[model samples]
Target chain A: SQKIEQNSEALNIQEGKTATLTCNYTNYSPAYLQWYRQDPGRGPVFLLLIRENEKEKRKERLKVTFDTTLKQSLFHITASQPADSATYLCALPTDGGSQGNLIFGKGTKLSVKP
Target chain B: DTAVSQTPKYLVTQMGNDKSIKCEQNLGHDTMYWYKQDSKKFLKIMFSYNNKELIINETVPNRFSPKSPDKAHLNLHINSLELGDSAVYFCASSQGQGAWEAFFGQGTRLTVV
Candidate 1:
């Protein structure tokens, strides 16, 4: 069975600092990994998606690094602001087809204090 | 306009009752999915539909049934809902079966009393 583990504890960081969250998986080799931001009572919003062949992907202040060897992915937010505070989820394709489902991590709740 | 939307943003129903939640995606995607987020915030995949066909069905209980009348719609019906079924249900869609990004709806917060 495949499993993904994230920091269950909330991460509290001051504004303007860089926040790094991790997602580690076991028993699966995901070809593609994605990141999503979910606010309270809202659905998960797509953030970034990176392939196993890509070392790192960045969008504005957000950066995602995929390490296939370790079966881990790191999500980074630079210049973090209070608006960036939300639960970040890491999702990966569970099966072969595009119609296949995604296995999501438990998610890491990030709190940016101003 | 909303890309993906679900009806009754919040649902409060009694145990043993039957209820249905509807979902529609205007993104013209070929694949749609139902996901359950538990109280602990662990999101689990319940079902997946591609072009009105079932593709992925997790180990969901028989009490739960998903119907896709069309490629853009996927509805979940729960029979004899149990107290343990209380959670948020999300509907998502992607461009194709192999698409990476999935657009999600606001979610339906179902509370079984």
Candidate 2:
């Protein structure tokens, strides 16, 4: 069975610092990976998606890197602020391709403290 | 306007009761999905519908049913709910059964007492 693991413990970082979260998977090689941001009592909002062929992707202060060989994806938020505190989730297609069904990681709760 | 919206942001019901959560998407997507987020905050896919047709059904209990009146709407109905069924349910949609980002609803926090 495919398994996704993330940092179960919450990440606490000072504001304006770089916060890096990880998503590692085993027994599967997905075509693409996605990152989402979820605030308290709210559904996840899509942040970025990086394909296996792409080494890294960046949007504003957010960056995502995918390493198929490592079966890992790293999500980074630079110049973070208190408002950036939220749970970040990593999602991959269940079938390893362009599929509607996605399996999400347990997510890493990031707290940017001032 | 909200691209994807679900009604009843919060739902509380007793065990053995029946409830339904309604979802609508204005994104004109053909693929819709229902996901369950437990206390551990793990979002798991339960069902997926494409063009009003059942596509992917995970190992979900028969007590849970998903109905898609059309591509724009997917409703989840749970019967004889158990305490274990208490979790946040999210409705999401994508452009199709392809490589597209999904837009999710506000999520319905269902609590079965």
Candidate 3:
């Protein structure tokens, strides 16, 4: 069976520091990987997406890197703030299936302290 | 305007009852999806519809049915809901079927009593 895993524990960091989250998958290769931010009692908002062919992607203060060889993706939030405190989800498409259908990991909750 | 939206942010119902949750997207996307987030915060895909056609249906129970009136709307109806069905239901939309960004709606929290 295919599985996606992230750090199950919460990540705490001080404001202005960089926060890094890891996503690892096994037994499948995805065409693209995506990152999303979700707040309490709300839906997830799209942040950035990086393709397997691309090494990294950036948007504003967020950056994502995909390593198909390692079967992992790393999400970085630079110059983080208290507002950046939320659960970050990493999703990937299944092997040759519905593009809209994504397998998501149990997101890692980040808490930024001021 | 909201890109993707769902009605009744909170729903409290009893087991064995039937209920429906509505979803709509104004982005004119071609594909729509339904996802469920359980208490453990594990998100899983349930169904996907493209242009009013069923494109993907995960190993979801038959009791849960998805009705897509058009490309912009997909609703989920649960028959004889059970206590295990309690979770946050999310609706999302994308432009095409291949590796595109998705816009998600504020999820509807369903609690079975």
TM, chain A, every candidate:
0.95, 0.97, 0.95
Residue B76 shift from truth in candidate 3, angstroms: 0.5
Fnat, model 1, is 0.78
TM-scores of chain B, in order: 0.98, 0.98, 0.98
Where is the poorest 10-residue window by lDDT in model 1 chain A?
A92-101
Docking tier of model 2: it is: high
lDDT string, candidate 2, A1-114, tens digits: 999999655999999999999999999989889999999988899999898899999999999999999999999999999999999999999999767589899889999999
lDDT of 1 at A44: 100
Tens-digit lDDT track for model 3 on B50-69?
Answer: 88999878999999999988
* Clash list (residue pairs), candidate 1: A98-B97, A98-B98, A99-B97
DockQ of predicted model 2? 0.83
TM-score per prediction, in order, is 0.97, 0.97, 0.97
lDDT of each: 0.91, 0.92, 0.92
lDDT of 3 at A6: 91
Among the numbered candidates, top DockQ falls to 2
How high is the TM-score of chain B in model 2?
0.98
Worst 10 residues of 3 chain B by lDDT: B94-103
* After superposition, candidate 1 runs with Cα above 4 Å error: A96-98
Q: Which candidate tops lDDT?
A: 2
